[model samples]
Target: MAAALELFGARDPDDISIDDVAAAAGASRALVYHYFSGKRELYVAALRSAAAGLERRPPPAGGAGSLDALAGALARYFDFAEEHAAGFTALLRGGGAGRCGEVGKIVEGVRGELFASLTRRLPVREPGALLRVTLGSWIAIVESAALDWLEHRDVERRALERLLVDQMVATLTAAARHDPEASHVLHNLKNDR
Candidate 1:
């Protein structure tokens, strides 16, 4: 499972064979087959393993207004993306893991967990519709930025991390202008800061 998880995250799932996993694990192909019926099953299991790693990460701890905590969270996210570059691409591209039903669910579960993680860091106990939308949009932005960063590799990681943090603050500031719920949260966040 560890071998498959590493390979799947670094290379295209289609390119990986049972033999490759066996070789990487120093086990026989027969042993691999003993655990998994086929390559797809193994791939799904590897993806599930990958998802669990991300899901298990503790939410960043600090005050709601702590931009430093947000930056720390972004740093960890980028570390994961960097470690799983090709796998992260495949998971988000809708051409690899997204093609499989189980794979899609795994990916969505990761996104949902990330969303919940962000919400927990905010001042709001329960977010209103507009704040919810704002948070959702911010997640999309972060994902898109990570994808672009992986493909281009032009922006420094620290710069990109700071940029994402600023983007979230700007988004919340904008949302607060028109939303009482957002306004309240923003006010609290600023006070804590």
Candidate 2:
């Protein structure tokens, strides 16, 4: 899997051959085929393995139910992003992730899980459209910023995380102004302040 991830992380699934994976793994091509029926199967398995390593250090002792808890979660996430630069880049913002339906679905699954996890931390139990959209936007922003940080190292990881959290709060406020339903959630966040 490590060999596959290294290769796939560097290029698209279609570009990588089973022979390449086997060579990198220091295993026979037949052995690689023995484990995975084919290249696509191996690609998906390796991608899934990379995604699984993202298991966070369980949020703060309290939970992601508060901004404080979210900061902690973001810190852990930022740390993961910093440490797994190649994997994070390839899995999240990589060029070919959206090309293949199978890989795209895998990427979407990971994204949905991330969205679900972050929302579960919110004070709002049943978020409305505006709130949901706002949060989703924030996640996208964080991903974009992480990509920039990976390439540029323009800011400290902690600073980047804090910047994302602050922007999310600002987004919540804007969402509140535009949507009555989101306003209520914003009120809850403000009350926490």
Q: Using TM-score, give the best candidate's number.
A: 1
List clash counts for every candidate, in order: 0, 0
Computed on alpha carbons, the lDDT of every model, listed in order, comes to 0.80, 0.75
Which model scores highest in lDDT? 1
Candidate 2, residue 151: the lDDT equals 83
TM, every model: 0.87, 0.85
Candidate 1 per-residue C-alpha lDDT over 73-100 given as tens digits, one digit per residue, 9 for 90 to 100: 8888888788767556656663343259
Worst 10 residues of 1 by lDDT: 90-99
Global Cα RMSD, each model:
2.2, 2.4
Regions of model 2 farther than 4 Å from truth: 55-57, 94-99, 190-193
Q: Where does candidate 2 have its weakest 10-residue lDDT segment?
A: 56-65
Q: Write the per-residue lDDT of candidate 2 for residues 1-193, one digit (tens) a residue.
A: 8777878777776677889989999999999988999887887777676677775446554433556666777777777777667677777754363346666776788778778887776666777777888888988888788888988997877778888878877888888889987777666655563
